[model samples]
Target: MTSKTGAHLRLLGVSLLALSIPMLSGVAHAEDASPGASTSDEASAQAKSGIAEGSDILVTATRANELAPVTASLQATQPQSIISRSFIEDSLPATADFNQIALISPSVSNYGAANGVGLSESKAQIRGFQDGEYNVTYDGVPFGDTNDPTHHSNTFFPSNTVETLIVDRGPGNASQLGQATFGGNINMFSRATREDASAEIKGSYGSYNTWLLRGVLQSGAIRQLGGAEVVLSAQHIGSDGARTYSPFKSNNVFGKIMIPIGPDAKLTILGTYNENSFNQPDKDGATLSQIAQYGKYFSLNNDPNSQTYWGYNHTHKTTDFEIVKFEANLSPFATFDNRAYTYSYDNETLSGSDVTLYATASAADIAKANMVTLTPGGAKTVGVPGYTKTNKYRVYGDIAKTRVDFGFGAITAGAWLEWSDTYRQQRDVDLLTGNPNYVEKAVKDPVTGIATPANIKFDQNSNTNHTEVFAELELRPIAGLKITPGFKHVNFNRRIDADYNQTTRYPQKLSNTYTVNLPFATVNYEVNPALSVYGQFARGFLAPPLSYLYVADPSFSTIKPERSTNYQAGAVYHGHNLSIDADVYKIDFSNKFAQDLTAPASQGVVYYNQGAVQYKGIEGQVTYAFTQAIAVFANASRNYAKTRNPGEARTQVANAPEYTAAGGILYKQGPIRFSLIDKYIGRQWFAEGEPDAYKSNGYNTAILSARYEIGPVRIGLEVNNLFNAKPVTNISPGKTTLFDQYYYQTGRAFTGDVTLTF
Candidate 1:
């Protein structure tokens, strides 16, 4: 995808979103509220202001401490967890990513990256489900690659942009819309605009030459704009990395504006843009011989002119996002909420690979020969440098929901519509001349105004349209018992208008549409104000990835959608000084997707449909305050995953840990604060049939942190991986042994940050 095409797509997406706003507003006005209303920052503010002064609302404040974690978990119909802003600040580095934040929750594991905070190198698993098997959303809007419904963490929202993280361990109610709702959902809420005018400056420096600087400015409500408030934030980060040749740099700009539409309504708009470039580090684990020769952080090549040179292998990515939201109180018993969003991602990854013509010799041997002397006739025969991929896409979506109170309980109804258009291609280039080598001819791109290689390895244009309508009712038949039932109708349409490969010189077009009806039910018994128990059953489905259509094989279109049935039971206890939450869940998933990672990158992705997989897990979390100045928190989860395919060599899913656990102690006295956090991850498998060599030993990591505050300035320091444990988090399988390919978790690192507020 070229820059000119990206620009045109962005403009078109913006125009479409802008034109749809009035239509959405008209729809919102026609309906009132229902049950389980979607909460917005505006709604939260309204609730705070509506509290009667000196009333019972103030009395409940005395019990707020007792709720703790239970306060958030007990409210959900299925297993769930919440991480607060304060906990995030206390437990993680300022630059941590969502994968890191997710580790605080049970049943979640984040394989740390080579460069700290480089999301591209990170992968997360929840309850034995891989990254693309679950749903992740931003403020209720789902964001991901149109081809796979999987996210590229490096191209989206960063940790600093979020204020809260909510992890639901089961398929949510009918209101939730996503392709991978079966494994569950992670919802990230953006930081709210401050109600008071203020400015904050933050800077951090960490081990491995990592540094970050950020600034935020907020303007309080302005009388001229009907009590409007705005916030602007900018940040820059760079790191030399914990692993050799793994360097990262990024810049982000974000803004938000909020306006009170009327006494009972509000409008908010947000926009963010990010640009990043980073060196691609070696992921293949070092062999025993290589480890002996170069240590753990070993990459394949070092020659300056080699394709695998640290200087030659890199990727560039850019993202732009914007959203408009409106919320209004239609009546004392009704509310309406709606949101529209537009976003685009453009990424180009350049990588080096073995020059096929000279593949007879090992890459190392070729490097050695070329380094010693070059052929007299021409430039040395170095490895090929090429764009591994160029993926550019624009997404637009809108959701409108209404909640209303009923005499028995409440009812909620909503609809969601989304569309995406993508342009993707890949081609090889000359290593010495920095021009395309495999191009059989040259042709001018109509949009880019540049001569493009006619011999594209892969080229395609894809478009996807998704629509859903959901309705749910909350029924309270007794004082302590509540039952909810919901249903959602979902439809997906994917069209691959053009798919081309230089080998065939033919364009193939494919289109597919899938429709399904999902039903969900939950039963909750309060038992008492301090205790609650809930059980839920739900069904969900995932459409086949759009990229499958681009495969050269026409049979690829026959792939079926993945589907799942989920069941969950949970209990929560909220006491005066303690809170506990526990849950057990099971999912029966069919038509699972599997990939052949052993294949080379230039071959594109090879996917197969694994018959079925069953997953079951148990998770528990507890928090206790021994005194006003001291507290302890702990969480753990155990998971079991197995495939039903009898012919398959391995029954257990690969890359998922058997268990995960975390514990921490917190202390605060006056202006001083402290925390000691510990985490443990159980063994993770890399191959089927429980191959002993292709598994990680799993390791322990700890963090110590302290902070002090005086006036408007705050200072903090943290030491992560305090023990400097160099544990393998992933393994690459080899024909003879493990470590043929792999990456290790980052080792011990230190970071210190200071913040000034005015």
Candidate 2:
């Protein structure tokens, strides 16, 4: 049988197995005792005490009973997982990148490139979906690049400031807003303001000469400031990464202020600033032969005189954010929330390609041949020494929501409005002097009196406007049944104006608008206080990305939105000693945008709507508390994502691993805590149509962490990739040559941290 046929058979078998899960409900029921309270009053009381994890932690009876089931949120009708603050601090990898912290959950994959956390490149994917296909938000506010839906991992908020990370394994309710909400969503909440005054300082040193220092100060509730509380934090990190020539550094500052307005109202303002720089990293993976020659973790040239020298390939980025939010309980049964926010991103980069151009000629001879001035580096490069790129953008938005409850049900309504203005350009410059050869037409620096060129490379000014309004109704007709239905209307507008290549072939100035309505319905049935079954049906939409709308063609307007029908069913159980959750999901996607490389080379690559695709998966997590101080947890996911386009040989998706598993043992005794973990990723196809030589090998990694506390002092140590495994983490899918295909991860590394609280 053919490989494609074998894959299809396996997928069918998995689906059949998943559909048979409901029959096992009797087995779970046999293990439980009599049920407990099932009233809203009980739930309200439980919420006040926070969620509990059974025997995972020893607590007083009041504390244990008071804690609610963490998985049973009113708005989360599908599967959801939460990584708590304690877990993040005590069990995660040393780097503590949000992307890494999320790996313990099911149906997620990440490529944390060879750089320090928050100082280089990284991406996270959900199910078989890529980076831009998922929604990520901080403090319930969504932010991303205006030109594209993806986010910059190194620019915005860092992991230290986060309190909780919640990954919702489905497109959430009507309140969630983003271009890629069709896939799933990630919700990050910042650390809460402290009621008591305290200060914390931490220092750490790890492998690859990595160093980190951070400090935080909390100004307890201030009576003079109307019971206000404030928090201030500063952090610095520097590292020589696992890869050759990849050095990184970053610095950040954050502040938050909270003021109590009245018995039922509060106002908060938060701000953050981050600046970082790192050597330019290649996206294409190095091949086996290249690794044999340069050793693993190889990067570009390191010779100072070469144009591709480590120092010559670098990027500098800065981000600034500020937000003000207000919350008020309008009445006993109603509440209102509103947020206003603004943020900006600035990036500048210098990089080079074409290694032979510099290696084959002398500086003076090459300069004479090209008629350009001789530059400082070794041989004059046949290519430009510095092809610089700059991107700067500013965003402003406001979101408001209101919730009201009647005797039998609740109503939620929300609206969002956002505006983005951006400036992007690329040009050649002198690498050594950092002087650009071209500037905006009719523009010049008054002091320098340098003439600006009217014709250069590419430059554009773009603006985007987004508006959304949504409403959801929650009805609780019976004591153990709840139903939620919601609808959202979205309108997006894009405007682009400027110059392209300055050639006669292309012109600039274009605008497009899209409007769509999405609907969602979910039902949750509580068989008992500790067990619940849920199902949902959602309609999702994704407009053509900015590239297809503006950058591809100046006047093309036929591109349409991508639509999907998503279905999910799951069961959750939270008991005195066991917490288990499972879910089965399937999505039918139409008008899926797939890259078309068959067009003439002169026209360049573009996107085409490939007819339809189907993605199905089964993911689940189980955690059992052995005792008050010990627990074990495991999670696994299996996915089958294939395109249904006619006559397509490669049905599989690229960069998507079919299976992933994570599990570990956790121990907490008195003032000390420790964990040993393992993570595995299955083999993946690099391209849709490819032979065995182009495929990627699977990899396994192990992590260990331990922490101890005494009074106001805490010490922690972490060992990542404990087996010292050198494995490829990424590969270029469609590249014909094997020379650029494999990117390896860092070997075993150690980090220790000491923190003092006062």
Candidate 3:
């Protein structure tokens, strides 16, 4: 290990040792007590006096059940963190999403930019893996965009509907299914229906002119429907975002029902519908010169003559998700489960070209420069050149699994099949007149041998079919020990039919299919009731993204699917007043892909396998309760990822933080609760495979929250970015100007909420 790595390890060791000192001393004192003394009697006396014996610290139900914002499971086979619903109710803001809730976990980093938390789509990274490198699932079903496996954090499930979240930091066992599973998995589960009937109304108001209102109704178990329980909720939220001329609003509705069939089976049905609308400029950030001339928050203007007008750039999207699941116990030793699901996303957007390019230019100037009004008869009086883009898709899928238990071990097998249909198109238009400003071109159809005139940029349709089959066996040869081995086969088929191809602007039809097999194994041992250790080895895989198939000639493409070999081990300890988990991991990544900058324009962008990469990291988290009402929590990670080439020196991966740390103090008593947390992100490069890449400095932010409850009413207040620290978090290189664009975190903000339950 390098000197820096050694130092990090040493620091982590010291921190863990310090946190264990109190527990260790208590255990030692208990062991040295008089033999004649009754241990049970002593423990009872300590409990009655609010004092805890070292040996019985966590033995009691109260201390063992103490709430921790982020914790580990004693039964986990890999490095994982569990965030419970109780933490969300008391700690996070009502407007929070999955990304905001994940901020407290180890080895995770995200900056939402000027949109504020949960106000817009945000990208988050795990370890050194980017957004599309990992997997995300709701309940147990995987969902994402059809073109690539990327998620929009604000468009789907909200915090109010979530019950629990698990961050699995590895390629899970063979039963885990998704488009990408090598980096890790973020699993989210919905809230369960309540047994008793109840109703609730909630409202919240916050900084940046944000507000939210929600209502919920729960139906108690009914004998008329086999003791079925149902829950329904509706909410609306609106915000004037941190950036100038950018606003956001959304409305959502959710419903769930559970029915007990016979005495050995159950059925569940759930559905969600949402509509979102926002106004934002095409360019996300501002160049340094623009920032200096305007302001850090400058994005769009009210002027109709410029391309940065907010009225000329806006988007509207609608989404829906539905699922039906059935589970049954076939016999005392066998069980079966199946789920059928469908989801869709429809988006329509109008955005202008680069704002900086036309910052001071006029419509006549643009026409003279041939930037707009390219057609022979197109009008030159139209101002603000832009485009109309649309993306609409729907997905259908099913998952079925069965498990059988024997005296020595258990077997699990599952299969997943999914299909998706998508249509996408983009066309240049005059923002003022709402008229198409197409560039006429005569292109011959390669297959039909017919020439036609086309005006639009591109119009295409695609279909994808994905299939996965997996089986695993869990063997328990001895007490307190278990071993699991499994394998999974994956196949993907993609087909595209385009009236006008993207860059080459030609009619084409193409299809491609890829297949791979992956294997996984893990061993876990329980040393005692309070401690456990585990190790895992797995092979991960990901097929090439959709963009790789955009070339003019598919036969000449040589791109390959990405793959990784992972090895990791970890330990978990839960005792008396403390809970701790730690792990170390290494991954050998190959078949990395990068765009070929030298490719000719006529051929469109081409991709090639660049080289291999080595990723290694250490991660840990600890929580200690000083008393029944107060606790302290801390977590840290040191990550290293570098590219490896034939005769080149290793370089750091772009957008991957060097290190991350978070800590906080939490207090929970009778009817009041409070917490203060701070998170830190380390330095990172903004661009990869470029000479003299720009590097961003590290930064940290803090939040404070408090809550109080009385009878059926609950009130909460949260202060974010308490110190008002604003630092650059992202950069986009300029294509024409010498100065690059930068994106910064929003300043301090506050929120207050109230809820009434009946």
Candidate 4:
């Protein structure tokens, strides 16, 4: 397989070089015709004049092999949503994760609370289905997470390493990555083709005790002969986060290289590595009173001294990953590409309680258990020490792509294959030597510290393989009007190998699974040189998450893959000073799976195929460039989504705020630039409850920033969450209700840094 794949790759490269010969000779003739600036610095000047990612569909846009988000490249399919790095920097979230960008899109909303997890549960609602179903890719390569779909993903390479982001709001042109069941797709790529060598660094501080340091490097330094171009980036982030027990550390390393094959062609190579160790304080479920007294959070495993609230859980999790990508530009207009990647995760958790150090007293001397009920970690707490679970996971994937310019139009096609394996081993201790739950033996011995008399083990192993194929046609039947149509097919084969009873209790084998998608069409009409209108019909689907398999514990097995259909229309208006974009969409879903807590805990929160749910909304975004020194950008959107279960009531998905509003302005004059951002996320539901109406806390977050650039040096300062306002998260309903859930927020924090470029 390796030799075959390699041989095909080399052949593709040779063919591309042969085709570029004619284009190269023509370019040389024109090179002397124009005596323009020839250095890297000169190219930057030319780019700023009018080279938007737009009409340049054949240039930088195709380098990453993704369908560019413009009327030109997308004419054969659907309206493509593109967010350039310039735009990303202007609306970056105060939080560390850049994936939060999903919240900035017109029809997407972030709906979730910070559970025991450190960050807000990013239960995103895109179009008419949940976010988990979307196909996420980087530089034309798929990068979806294998964790439960309901869980937030940590697979990004960070903002500094990005060039542009493409959001296909619905099922996109089906080239290989057609697995999206509902939410559709998100794609990203790095900056390439630069002739200059430069680097930059920046730092910031926020409302909480937050700090971040970032860096960027770009160049084609070795391009004089048998040349090469490269981009590299590294960053470190540490923060005293706002939530009850959230504190985190994140680090990343990324690089991309381009090697020339001929005057008009080159082979592009790219790689990325990110590792983060996040600390959790186990204060997720603490009560207001207990939170205020015990520092609001503490380690549930080690600091057994915490008596106020024994619910503390704390520890660190590490995510280590790397990816390598290669592309052969057989010619200026036609190319072939391939990529291989590996992602791994390691988690170590420790649980601590306030009642572990207690000592039993004589029957006569045991006056009484204090009226306040001695807290878990108090002087009279239980002695059962604790238990721990450690897990290791690894995932691998590879893909191949080819694009050919059939004289009439361009044909883009590709396929992706991937697999994941996991191993988990847990040990349960007898915190109290015998039965800690026994009333008489509950207390611990201060001397011996209540030794663990026995330890039980739990082990599990599992894996899955995914395969896909997709294609699209960018056709131009005539001038000014373009049409695109695409199709995709995906197959998944998975199984579980587990030992629940120390024996082969859970057998393992691959089960065949498959789905095919068709994103029929997208039409674009260029009314004039400055304005355009587009419409599309698309489909997407999301496979059942690995978590769903947990329920198959040999009993109460259930579920089906979820799916969604979408219809969208939008207009883009670009004038001399004002730019406005408007989009409206309606999405429908089938077999949506969600958490239902009303059912008992022993059974866990199971998923029920809540039939037929729908989401319809409108988004209006506007930007005004008043002058070379000042500009303003604004966006507002509303989504109306509801469960389809009849008489059973219409409920909104968790973390889905109905109205999302944003407005920001940037002022730049010479070496000084300033910016202000404000965003509003309307209230939404958080749990399965009793009331017919939903429950949520409304919130608004704001930020202030400034930067100074002199020659090759740029310095910046930013104050995030300037209002120190905590977005209302979680909901506590029913006073005096025994089952009422508690609510809280991640507090505001602050951070600062300097960078240089040459």
Candidate 5:
């Protein structure tokens, strides 16, 4: 997509959203408050005073020991738009019961689906960084899969089971320890029983043959008995699928228990199990014949204006996923999290050599049998190709923290140790013979032992142990001014035992490497009660890119970890009826992890740190209420990123949507509340050099939702991808999984839902 196209789309989206503003302007404010809602008490009075106060960002993030502070970073909680519990109840995903909305922050972006996967395997990215290069935490502890289930970390608790979510952009805090590159950390707080029990149920059905059913039952309080809360939820979804000739299904269960030790202490144990199954759909793109006949991605069999299954991209597969987690929380001070995941999948990834070929051939052979055919030489190995894969991954760790408060200021500190391991096995077989993809070409040369199967078996079982010691202190010598400084020392060692069983040779045990001392700092000044200014200067680290980790070879050694120096200044202000926040930031990135293209082809691509980049931008959001029944909000962001030197052109850096703007209005009256939102993502130059070829650019997507209530039962309708936006792709060097053509986004659709609270 070009900048012009992007700008045009943004204008169109903005106009549409603005048109609906009046639709929710008139509403009868429902004076009857929901249970647990403020009850005209001290808490209610404070909550009603500021939009930021109701965020629960501080409590969920830093686990603040006290009440709400007048000047807090709205960006701090999520630093982006929030996916509130109310939002989840409206449009649920496949693993709704055990899922929390992700990449919902300005710094985060979500693009994949959990169709054939589970909550833990859902893919995401943060701050222009791949999801794979992230550090996740369940109540502030290490959370990320080494091998088992790869990048699935969403299963610690269910969406409804969560109390709040906090996203820290850029490298994580001194407390977070793991393999994090450009992405920040996500802090998920499990529901606790400081209040009463609540039960809710929701169901929805919509376009593209979609349906969703979800329910949550939660145990509230044992406050007198040291505070105990139990929660359980289940979700089921069935969709005819997004594109042609595709259908999908999934089921998930999430449950957990929270036991408190004292007013200042707590213990938590949680587990989630998912039984998910689905068929991978084909890719979506324009075929050659279609391109010539009616332009790219066109159909002739249908009406000139209609769409055809032929233009849709398709990927086929069957996969089963599962995950379990345990976490211990010690009140407003410390937390420990451990998780285990196992998954197995089988599928035939059929990449039709070309759409034009498929189209021309089909057109030439309808009488023979209206079927698509491929030449033996047409199909190439795709992914772990003849897919038979198994993985068992685990992470066990804990942190002990203690904090002290004095009349002048407060001090906080903590340390942790983590052990992670994974076992992965993959083998591709010939769909017909049920043997390795290739059989020995019975030749006299066969004496050399059945040549290493054409389609080989590459398996690896490894263990990683990471020991980290870290600490942070917040010194507030003055009532509204504060300073924070922190540092972390981490040592990681990994051992991999790999085997090419086909050759029947001794298994190979590979050597390992490490990364050392990282420090960061930030300072803030609260000029007044309703306003504050703060600036943060810090350092961040990222392991050599994914290229190095997945395509491992001795030639690709000494992969230095990437380093970054980032700085930001922002302000937070809240008036009686409105709140606003804005920040400007820049990141000087170095030691980029890129492939060794300079090396001979015989050297094999070994990923290592080599390039440098600069990422700088500004982001902000505003919320205003005209009356208790009417509210309006807008969020905007802009970023500039490029290779440090003009010499470099393209690199699949991460999710950097150069510009984003969203606006919406929420109106509620007697049982009826309607919200209309418009979102715009500016044009992004995805790849380098081939600016005109082999790359994907950015586009704008939007959403709108409205709800009507009758007693305790509420019904709603949601319209997503209002304009049927296209999926943006990035330019990849060669044969990279991330293509210049990425996956197509979901088109415009409607979802009708019903919800009940008891």
Candidate 6:
């Protein structure tokens, strides 16, 4: 560890010790109250009513916590928001993905265009942090692509399979483990197994010829197998999409089994598989000129001779995830938990070289521009340019955590180890004949000194090894007070051996390793059972992406890992009929890295540390229950992220909204429920530090949901973009046309579903 790291650790230790000494000497008589715990009276009422605080019937309950769509727990030491499964099922569309669900939270923005909601992958930003900058975890296990710590929103766990989502708006305590912790953490938990046997069947139909069929089964608890429980589900969804010639289809199957090993121990196994196929052009959005001439939603056409043909642009993906977990309480004061997991993603895609090419160019003009000779003896052929690409990767990891309690406090320690292997390749092909455009050439392997025949754009194989270890002490010196001080060490090793590397198109082999020490401290005081206040300080770290090594020699690279210092304070309150949470945070970010687009390709896409950034924000959310059948919810955030270079003027970060807001009203009575919510994203720039960047105006979208239950049958209806709003949500400089390309949110769409429970 560096001296700076050591100094921070010392400071944290001293501060924690000083705060605990006086409280430890006092007599302790009151029972412990966790940060988010409710008052004793409220708990007693809930128990008597036989309904959990965040149950699906929350809208019908009179409790404050039950009526809130998004709220924080009283025990939070940093800014956080929790979205319950009840809210998801009652207010959001049944086909909603995690991204859509998160969009309702403060400081979050997402764009679902062309393919409509859940039909295509969507990217979401939190407090101005992009996808690869944050950490996403499922059931306490972190998973993402190896090259970059980015997630595919439509690939893994859908909303139907998730039980809860917690957005931690800061680098949490030492116990939070992931590749990128500086930005924030989006934690997703799997659905819990029920204690009662049941079965359900559902069918849904929506606009644009969308359809979904699903079935679920639960085995309750089987006494014969030591009280083992099981749950299984299968579903299929298809859509024609909102854009022209864009369609999607998916099939998913999931299963989970839990076995009790005595009263103090348990074993759990879970697995899920998904297969997805979609037709979308290579160009993600439509250029201004193309949209003006062919309509705003134009993406592809039916002409077989054109490069924009939908048949020539399609993708297929297969993914699977599995986990085995064991938990045991060795003693009254000690506990242990371990989990081993593995997941894989395989994608095969065929897409036109440029969808914008055929917008203005004639068939003959396109052929002349892309003519190629496949072999030495063959004549020049008028080929429709396209490519076939594949990305396949598998990850294996294990996590172990142990906690031991003492009279004054408790100590928690854990370690996470993971390994990933990936294979990627792309090849130029004639879209018309589905044949290679180039002749095979002999290429020698970078590692084995063996020559092989290959004709492709690029072929590469890479692997990564990651390790993290952390230890923290939770000191509860007195009743309703908790202080934690901890530290963590993270190391990452990446290696790539490419027969034909990207950009440079040459053989290369490279390896690099990064390591850092992070320190964390937090303090929480429960003023009362229904209210709590806390403060947190932590250091976050993220290693350089794999693209940093895509050079002839990686030894000379000077880019450093990104790091951040985060400080935050927050308060949470739960009253009889109202709940509210608010927080303020500031982050000092250093070693911001980006690809130097101005550099020549011969240098293999150079990456450099741009400069520093300062991020500050204030966020809050509230829910008020007017009656057992009516409630109101609201949240807002003011965020500012500015880049500070040595000599350049400070500029706003790209895509960082100035502010965000959401409000809605919900009603539930008898066997009926209804909700209407609206979300707004404030002004933002399209490019960082660019003089000619486009500034987008703020936009608003609303969604309405209604459901009715009769006996064992339930019916639901959802309308997204209820007012038929169409606004540009994303923009990028065009590659083929002089005008910029824009992506707009889909217009009004409706979905209806009927479910039967037995």
Sort by TM-score, top down from the best: 6, 3, 1, 2, 4, 5
Q: lDDT score, residue 241, model 3?
A: 88
User: Residues 1-758, candidate 5, lDDT per residue (tens digit)?
Assistant: 11221121111011111111000000001112211221111122111111111112211121111111111242142232334444444333323432225533454455544222131134555555556555654444445555421354433344544544445555534544456624555555444322457887988788767787888886766555544666778777677655334455556676765554433223445555544443332333434444455542232232111123322222333333333333332322233333343333333333222222334435343222222112222333321113345555556665554434343544445555666566666554433233444322221112334334334345666777667666656566776565666677767666666554212222556546566787766666656645667666667765542224444255455577777787877877655566677888888888766666776656545555677877778877666767656767776677666666446664434445556666666665567666666656555544453254543456655666678888889888877766766553332232432222233455577778888989
TM-score of each: 0.85, 0.84, 0.89, 0.75, 0.74, 0.89
lDDT of 1 by residue, 163-253 (tens): 6666777777777767787887777667666556889999999898989999988787677886687888898889876666767888989
Candidate 2: residue 398 lDDT (0-100): 91
> Model 4 lDDT vs. the true structure?
0.50
Candidate 5 lDDT for residue 260: 47
> Stretches of candidate 3 above 4 Å error?
1-65, 358-371, 374-382, 439-455, 596-605, 689-693, 736-739
Candidate with more favorable, higher lDDT: 1 or 4: 1
Give all candidates' CA lDDT scores: 0.67, 0.65, 0.73, 0.50, 0.47, 0.74
- Of models 1 and 3, which has the larger TM-score? 3
Model 6 misses residue 370 by how many Å? 3.9
Model 5 misplaced stretches (Cα beyond 4 Å): 1-83, 90-104, 107-110, 113-125, 147-162, 191-194, 222-227, 262-264, 281-385, 439-451, 501-506, 545-556, 600-607, 649-655, 694-698, 726-742
How good is model 3 by TM-score? 0.89
Better TM-score candidate (1, 5): 1
Off by over 4 Å in 6: 1-62, 359-369, 376-380, 439-455, 595-605, 690-693, 735-739
Model 2 ranges with Cα > 4 A deviation: 1-75, 116-119, 281-290, 354-384, 430-455, 501-507, 550-557, 594-607, 733-735, 738-741
**RMSD to the native, candidate 4?**
9.9
lDDT of 1: 0.67
Question: Which candidate should be chosen as best, given lDDT against the real structure?
Answer: 6
Give the Å shift of residue 279 in candidate 3: 0.3
Evaluated at residue 745, the lDDT of candidate 4 is 37
Error of 1 at 474 (Å): 1.4
